[model samples]
Target chain A: QKEVEQDPGPLSVPEGAIVSLNCTYSNSAFQYFMWYRQYSRKGPELLMYTYSSGNKEDGRFTAQVDKSSKYISLFIRDSQPSDSATYLCAMSRGDSNYQLIWGAGTKLIIKP
Target chain B: DTAVSQTPKYLVTQMGNDKSIKCEQNLGHDTMYWYKQDSKKFLKIMFSYNNKELIINETVPNRFSPKSPDKAHLNLHINSLELGDSAVYFCASSWGQGGADTQYFGPGTRLTVL
Candidate 1:
């Protein structure tokens, strides 16, 4: 099994609808979880980051981490067409020099 | 001003040829990294440097080498590239060490080895 798993979904949703993206990992030592958004033909841009478990919210976006279940989620509320992008989940063990283990990104499309 | 810049936004070369992708960051970051995104969109870390010193070199083949002559530059040189080497290469930089540091990525260079 891959260390980090995410569905490569061309998930479609209406504008203003709430969208949820998730990732599951096999490594219990992964303490830092991150969400990155990548537009077409561009590099991944860091969106949300969290340490350990719990939820962190910024504007209409929220990131949740469930360490017990080895799951992490990124919720986008009132999505817009401009929000359409590939979302990548990454995790690291938080060692001194951390190298990220990234998931196969989920492609999301917010229809107008 | 662009924080991170990469030359040859698109690279096309024949198999068995040599190529190099240059990366530079004006962010004054201490840590730099190279990541490869395959056609399947699977990203893997290929190499990392700290202040021009090699820190992490992943399981990539020896044909791939990362050179950092200064803290602001990290370049990847591929010798006798193969078909499998065709992928998007990204250069990233972070302010410090550890997982907590936020990495800033450059616009990737898409390499096609035919």
Candidate 2:
């Protein structure tokens, strides 16, 4: 099984809707969790970052990590068309190397 | 100003040819990374350098090479490119090698190997 698993969803939702994107990993050693947003033809950009099992909120985005279940989620409130992009979840063991294991991104579309 | 930048934004090369992608960061970061995003949009780290020293090297083929001449520059050179080499390459930089360090990414280089 892959270390990280995420549904590659082209999930479509109306503007102002709440969107949830999630990822699950098999490794319990992952301590640093991150969410990245990638626009078409562009590189992935860091959106949200959280350490260990907790929730971090920034603007309309919230990142939640549950170490017990090896799950992570990014919640978007009042989603906008500008939010339409691919959401990727990444995690690392916080080791000296700091190598990240990535999830296959889920494509999200916010309709007007 | 762009924190990270890559040259040759788009490359279309024939199979068996050799090409290179250059990455530079003005962020004065100590760590730099090279990642490959396949057609399925799965990102995989190929190599990483910290302070111009190789730190992380994945199981990539020898045909792929990464060079770090300085802390701000990491270049990837691909020899004998195959059709499977067609993918978007990204360069990222961080202040440190710690896992909690936030990575800043550059505009990707789209390589089309035909």
Candidate 3:
């Protein structure tokens, strides 16, 4: 089984909608969780990151991790057209920062 | 300055051809990695190097080798590439092996094997 699993979503939402993207993992050892945004033809850009299980807020994005359930989420408050891209959830265990288990990205399309 | 960069934004080659993708990071990071993104967009780690030392090899085929001349550069060379080898490849680098260390990625190279 893949360590990380995410729905490959073409999640479409109207402007200003609250968008929630999620991922689940089987490894209980994962302590670092991250969310990355990848636009067309570009690399994955780190959007929100958190250590262990907690909440970290930055601008309109909030990253929540539940270590107990091995689940992570990325929430967008004011979704915009520019926010339309692929969202990928990545996590790593202990000191293996060089190895990140990535999920199949979820494509989000925000309507104008 | 670009933190991470890759050459040949797009490559089209025939099957059985050998090609190498070059990567460089100016972030002063000691660790570098190579990841493959398939058509389904599943990003998988192929190899990693720290200080020019091979640290992690994810059972990638011997035909696929990663060369690191230094901490700042990591290159992937695939020999006799197959049609399945056509995918987007990404290079990334980070400072340390910490839970909080942020990894920066380079613009991916889209490889098309005919």
lDDT, candidate 2, B1-114, per-residue tens: 999999999999999999999999999999999999998999999999999999999999999999998899999999999999999999999987865678899999999999
Estimate the TM-score of every prediction: 0.97, 0.98, 0.96
Isolated chain B TM-score per model: 0.97, 0.98, 0.96
Model 3, A63-86: lDDT tens digits are 999888888999999999999999
Judging by lDDT against the true structure, name the best candidate: 2
Question: Among all windows of ten consecutive residues in candidate 1 chain A, which has the lowest summed lDDT?
Answer: A93-102
Q: How many residue pairs clash in each candidate?
A: 0, 0, 0
**Ranked by lDDT, top first:** 2, 1, 3
**Model 1 per-residue lDDT tens digits across residues A31-95:** 89999999989988999999999999999999999999999999999999999999999989878
**Residue B49 alpha-carbon offset, candidate 3, angstroms:** 0.3
Model 1 spans with C-alpha error above 4 angstroms: none
lDDT of candidate 2 at residue A58, scale 0 to 100: 98
For candidate 2 chain B, the 10 contiguous residues with the lowest summed lDDT are B95-104
Per-residue alpha-carbon lDDT of model 2 for A26-94, expressed as tens digits? 999888999999999988889998999889999999999999988999999999999999999998887
DockQ versus reference, model 1: 0.76
Error of 2 at B78 (Å): 0.8
